[model samples]
Target: MRGVSLIILVIFFCGASSATAQFYQTTTAHVSFYSSAPVEDIEAVSTEGISVINADNGTISFKVKMRSFQFEKGLMQEHFNENYVESEIYPHATFKGEFLEKIDLQITGSQENTIKGTFTVHGVSKEREIPVILNVLDGGQRINLSANFQVACEAHKIKIPKILWKNIAEIIEVNVNADFQFISK
Candidate 1:
């Protein structure tokens, strides 16, 4: 009877360890965006983005502070926060979604996949399907993800003044690169 109880305990411990490995997260994900207008190009980047992924369920989430983005010119940043996105009112942008295909955590190397989810910006949420490249590195201890997508200013309620319309594009190109580490739940 003692031997049977010991076996059950070991199995329980093994199961628990594996379950904990399914969670991966990071707080320093890099996010950038660019807008090409007829007159000038606008760009900004934020390295304070936070993200998480559930390997067992293919669920993913990301949150980026609107005020954290840094632009080349201070005036550009000010205009972005005060007039465009209204960062004081809508402080953060978020994305929550799931991978359309199964992701094997044990797999090494890169895989192309699509994620479908809601992307909220400037207080507006829109459904988006983003294509991503997942690179599993260090024997699954780390995962690097890269994706490029476009967001429409009008769709997100970000208003570009007619006077400066030539300085801002209607559609913005966004890029994300995140490195996540496996964490125990």
Candidate 2:
């Protein structure tokens, strides 16, 4: 019957639409970096980071303004923006990559996965694989992400004066945390 065929077609389209998961996004993701040495302790935090995640395919991207990083000491911040990172010249840092493990919106749990992507900072780009934890929070409606990684100063072409070598470390520890909510587009 034509009625029966029409009913089946409507149901099929409804089911197909529900199969794909919604995209998640956040604007105030937090990112921090810490560098410690015997001569000085350096650290900064930036709460202006932005991130987007594709729940269907596990694709992720992030961007943060270099000048948004806040340091404890004013002199340190000035030196960092001028002599070290040159924030005036390179104003932003970004990452684009995908998770190795697939994310299922129907499930609610945490998965440890590696994200391989290109990281661009201070006008230099490098390929990196970072370990991260993805959690399906709030009954699969929200996603929580956290990652800790090390970035080498030389990799980003950040120059440190020889006199200040004792004050700054060669490698910096970066921390990222974000809670994303599903956004229907």
Candidate maximizing TM-score: 1
* Tens digit of per-residue lDDT, candidate 1, span 1-185: 32343233233322333544476777888999999998999999999887777777677878888999999999999999999999999998988888999877678999999999889999999999999999998988899999999999999989888898899999999999999888655
CA lDDT of each prediction against the hidden true structure = 0.84, 0.81
Give candidate 1 regions above 4 Å deviation. Answer: 1-21
lDDT (C-alpha) at residue 122 in model 2: 84
40-131 per-residue lDDT for model 2 (tens digits): 88999998777777766667777777888999998999988988889899988888788888886667888788988889998999999999
| Residue pairs in candidate 2 whose N, alpha carbon or C atoms collide under 3 angstroms | none
lDDT of 2: 0.81
Clashing pairs in 1: none
Q: What is the lDDT of residue 89 in candidate 1?
A: 97
